[model samples]
Target: MKRILKRRVLIPVFIIVFGLIQFKTIDKVNMVVPAEFGILTIETPPKEVGELISAACFDCHSNTTKYPWYSNIAPVSWWMKKHVEKGREKLNFSKWSDYSEEKRDSLRLKSAELIEKKWMPIISYKIIHPEAQLDEDQRELLISWMKK
Candidate 1:
């Protein structure tokens, strides 16, 4: 009798807790802006190079990210939000005009170094966003542009 009562109480408690957790997860999603990178660099690269950068880097490292369907889900949305926030914190292409020349140069060098090491875009990101994976030619284009 006690076991049956305990089970009844535990089930409802679990359901209530789960509901609360799902609700709490909703707040983790950061508000997205309508505009993207207004100005990604001090000097715009050629159109081809610009496109390459957009495909490979802009989603995370810029002011804009086109959230996919999965991004609407709870934990995934939370994780993606944090990732974009961190990425933007590290390098916000949208804010290029705000950076001083020395800062831009330093960031370019760092960006190049990360790309050379195959550390940028991150593995998990590439797995889900295969379009974001940079081919050798694309990599070269970005590296060259950064150096320039």
Candidate 2:
């Protein structure tokens, strides 16, 4: 009788835990404004530079994020939120106009330096996002764009 009761409780508990693990929630927020509305424009950046930056950094640094299916999971979503928030705070490309000219130049140089050092996409980020692993050619292109 005790063994049967134990099995009943354990089965229900396991099911509940599994169900909780499957539950997902998503909350997205827009964080960009027009460059004209602020103090900058994308007119200076080359098309390739813009494309590379978008593909590699826009998810965390822009108003819109292309959330992954895994991002729907609970713990992963929570972590992603934290990472995105911090990344945006550090350097929001979408809000480039809001920064002072000095800040803008400093950020541009930092962006170039980070890329040349193979540190922009970050190793941990590339581990999960293989497409972000830029080749030597891509790196050179970014470096050249930055120098301009």
Supply the global lDDT for candidate 2: 0.76
- Per-residue lDDT tens digits for candidate 1, residues 17-47, read 7666566453334345433334444476799
Question: TM-scores, in order shown?
Answer: 0.78, 0.76
Q: lDDT of each structure?
A: 0.76, 0.76
Q: What's each prediction's clash count?
A: 0, 0
List candidate 1 stretches off by more than 4 Å: 1-19, 25-41
Candidate 2 lDDT by residue in tens digits, 20-105: 87665657667547655321255456677677777888777776677888787777887887778888899888777778878877
Model 2: lDDT of residue 108 = 76
The local distance difference test score of model 1 is 0.76
For every candidate structure, what is the RMSD over all alpha carbons to the true structure, in angstroms?
A: 4.2, 4.0
| lDDT of candidate 2 at residue 13, scale 0 to 100 | 92
